[model samples]
Target: MSPTTDADLSDFVFVRRNDGLPIEEIPFELVERKGVGHPDTMCDAIAERASRYYSQYCLEHFGRIAHHWFDKVMLFGGESDLDYGHGELVNPYTVLFAGKGAHRCGDTPIPLADILRRAAADVLSEVTTGFDADRHLVIDCRIVDHQGAGRGRSRYRPESHDDLVAIGDPSLVSNDCNLLHAFAPFSRLEQAVLRIERLINGPDFKARHRDTGWDVKVFGSRNGEDFSFIVNMPFLASDISSFDHYLSRKAECREEVVGLLRDTLGGDPAVLFNPTDRNGRPYLTALGSVADTGDVGAVGRGNRVTGLITPMRAMSIEAPAGKNPLDHTGKLYGVLAQQLARRLNEMTGKPVETHLFTSKEAPLDRPDQVVVRVHGLQDGGDEEQKIRAVVAEALANTAELTREIIVTGVTMW
Candidate 1:
């Protein structure tokens, strides 16, 4: 990809609606501070960690046997402020996972469910802490069987499978007192269906319309010739002044913001935009990429998945009398989170999931703000280094734009 300096800013400018409501940028600390122990954060961390571990297991153990093998996985979290009477619920958050992979033999093929489950279990074991084993840590694994005949000696055959394996289980041991018991005997196919349902019917789906007052939008697509990808961008005000302020301080906070973006949006560089009509507003853009295969069998062989996850500290749009003034600050952030997820999916040719979280409290210092954090897990031995390396690089690149915005006081709406 060309550097930002190389590209003409004119083509990249993104305009908002005619209304004066320009999008705004939110601090990463507000969204990512949920801490590692939070249920939602733990779920996301475990699911991705497990999926990656499983993928490596396949590559190491089955690479010699299968002609091709790979996996696509995603993690999501959600919460309702209405559940708690006053402040937002802090500890009991929901986490979800969707994963799929394929393996081919010379003529015969094997389902990868067994390997996926073991990997998931391994990840859960490594990450679970503080919470009771029975009530904390839930695992869901999905496997799609895409087995068929080879078109020709060199022709690619992208087969679509109808069979699925879905499994949901709790990482902790069972406790009688905990009513929120985990499911058992998880199936990979069932998990796949659940993931699809979330992609199409989850909260993010309801959050996509302009009238819905939602903060984000997500979209996705996949094909055999090319790899699957997801994109997550934000839609906000186009005023450049906000961008300027953000750029001015980018150096101080860029590392955390960019790191979060790369981890969430894949390796793609986050893009900042200035629409033609608005000289003062700016928005952020992110793209994810995947490989494309060539051959007759590869035609129409792909799965596109998109998910939107939004977490709000409060739902009331109107500020209460005699109360601290509400900021109404993070709505644009919710929207941007959705957009980034969609963009990443499109670019990578892989299934995509996006999440958004907001706080109702005007000043974020109040206990009302929702906190979120992310972590990764790897297989035993040498695999740990590889996972850390990928995550480290993503954090480094992600820091650039975030820091730039803070220091230069530049806004890319």
Candidate 2:
């Protein structure tokens, strides 16, 4: 597809709605974020990294990305024992790699299982320090070579590079019917929740506080201008000396988080940590994540592509993790919707929600319908024209979008 011109604008719909209230003023808003080491987030990370490695291999060897989607990963937690100053994982965690991928191009075989295992190890090592991936993690590959539902066998089991349709037509064709919806200009409470999570998981915070674990979950609710958070943060058992020490460390961490939230939201918000803590029991873990024990997680159950699950704003049920970066509308459209909404919001100085819809085999650049809604829009004519330009340009440059997703490892969790 060529650069978008005036003619390309006709395919999209742009409207201005002034009735919808901004998220903060809407009375009741809810947002949840699963941190880096949460089991669900772990599955998302492993699956997406697996896809990235697979795509890179295909591009380096065959000059194009082969068909692959590893979005069905699962992490089954292992058995563990923990005390105030001692912890150990007796059984290793098991990561099951599911979905399908092209295993060969003509006679050249692809080492897909090895690539996936390496990807899992790389991500797991970065997220946890108590467990060694080579010794304490088991990587299993149940990924197959068959495309599900209506697609033919050759799609995932292609015999040659010529069978990879996307290689011939750089403007990839959508593999499924999907909808992508996203909004921009996060409210004060939403921004505060994100900032709090980052503050706790950041490197500087980790350096100062060694007792804190990575399996943090932040849940925030806002009623009008008042915001409150219930955070599930785990403490490393090996770092705490006694019950009093655990309580003291938690108090310090809570103070730091509340300070950050007050600065970000410009108000005093209530922050609670480990509500389940009792007289002699606290939230403690061996490997920083609950997954070091018997807890399990599956993909598509964690945070959305924006890194938070916001029910108050426009959201999609679709999960973008592990989908092919080239032709999978499930991944591409979601990422693009976010970018478009932010651009329009910045341009119009109003909140924006972008929705893109497409069907099976549709061209990547052209969706079946494109809807751009500007909340609290001041005027229509010229603003709508500008919105159309943004949509048209995005639709015309999907090839570049795919490249960015592959190279940068676009955020899906």
lDDT of 2 by residue, 67-97 (tens): 8899999999988789878888889999999
Task: Indicate which candidate wins on TM-score.
Answer: 2
- Error at 272, model 2, angstroms: 0.9
In model 2, what is the error at residue 293, expressed in angstroms? 1.2
Instruction: Write model 1 residue lDDT over 1-413, tens digit each, in one string.
Output: 12222122223212111222111112110111221222222333343344344434433544321212222232232221221112122222122233223443334354445544444444333322122223332334444334335323221122322121111111111111100001111122222222332332234532441111111222222121221222122222211134454344323232433344455444543322212215543222110000000001110011111111112112122111101011112322222232343343344333323332323321211112111111121225443233223222322232232223223322111
Quote the lDDT for 81 in model 1. Answer: 26
Model 1 alpha-carbon miss at residue 326, Å = 40
* Number of clashes recorded per candidate: 96, 1
lDDT of each: 0.25, 0.83
